[model samples]
Target: MSLSKDKGEQNPLEKALAAYIEALQTKPVLTKAVTSGCISAIGSLVSQLIVPNPANGGKIVWRSVAAYAAFGFVVSGPLIHKFYILLDKMMPPKKEKTALDGIKRVVVDRLVFAPPFLLLFLYVITILEGQGHQAAIARIRESFFPVLKLNLQVWTVFQYVNVNYVPPKYRVLFGNALALIWSVFVASKRRKMALANK
Candidate 1:
């Protein structure tokens, strides 16, 4: 009966999903930003669910979720996408001689971008939650090293494969997919810290 789609044709859901992925491929920055916000919001929701909260009838901390999602959409996603583009432009990825180039990309990414990004994420979350400047500084001071250590351990190895194997256009997508787990980890830590402080 259907001329456009045969019986064996993709279902509507699959077609919609395929179209969405294709759109993401076309617009890397916006797609990644939207993905970041969604993943971060999911992470925050999970964190609140898992972390113990006896106060406020245990409802989800919608404010934290909103703040993190907003930051991820506005800052982390676009910034990292642009950062990876710049890195690739500066140090073109080599297909054959990947060992050295991969190492260089990893080093530069970890040293230059990771530190500042982590700091900014923590500070932004703290500030958005209306924490004072002094409290924000204290939160950064308390959390920075631990988060950085985890970041180094995780991203160093991950970026090696990413830089060497992944194509430039898909790099941000790859990174953001992996960042979903990292989002949960960071959100959990933030929840713990907030509870401790309270």
Candidate 2:
């Protein structure tokens, strides 16, 4: 039996845990910026189908991607990082592991990180709809609630994956894939509904 631990000696396990924690502490700001940009790009591609009637002419994919990437890089990175730090301070976790301890992380991200994002996304939709006509805007509003519901549901799940499995560095890539899926689903369904109504 190792009596060193008995004497409150910090063994290899304690050392490793401490080191792992310190590594996590060194989060780079750039990582968040990159991640947000990538996800926005994914969303843009998905949104492409919805605008221009995919007819009159315009490159929705590139435009949406550029718009979202800028929003993420310029706006989201700083805001989200600050938001997380604030949550950690206000809702200091008993442990950073999982559960309410974990719940805290998810709640903070969802409650704080999501509202502005949703607003931004809605704004994007508005701009896209506006490009067409008043009728287009009405169509979007009609489809908005259902599409938004799906987007939220998917995002909730993705955020969990992002918070838990993702290191800060790779979070952007993972989130991008998820966002793409959500956008595709929403755009596709909205189109389907529109055609059926026609």
**Candidate closest to the true structure, highest TM-score:** 1
What lDDT tens digits, residue by residue, belong to model 1 across residues 134-174? 88899999999998998899788988878667876667667
Q: Which ten residues in a row have the lowest lDDT in candidate 1?
A: 1-10
**Each candidate: what lDDT?**
0.81, 0.62
Q: Give the residue spans of candidate 2 off by over 4 A.
A: 1-27, 49-63, 85-98, 120-152
Candidate 2: global Cα-lDDT?
A: 0.62
What's the C-alpha lDDT at position 135 in model 2?
51
TM-score of 2: 0.57
- For each candidate, what TM-score against the reference? 0.82, 0.57
Cα-based lDDT at residue 20, candidate 2? 43
Candidate 1 accuracy as TM-score:
0.82
Please report the candidate that would top lDDT against the real structure: 1
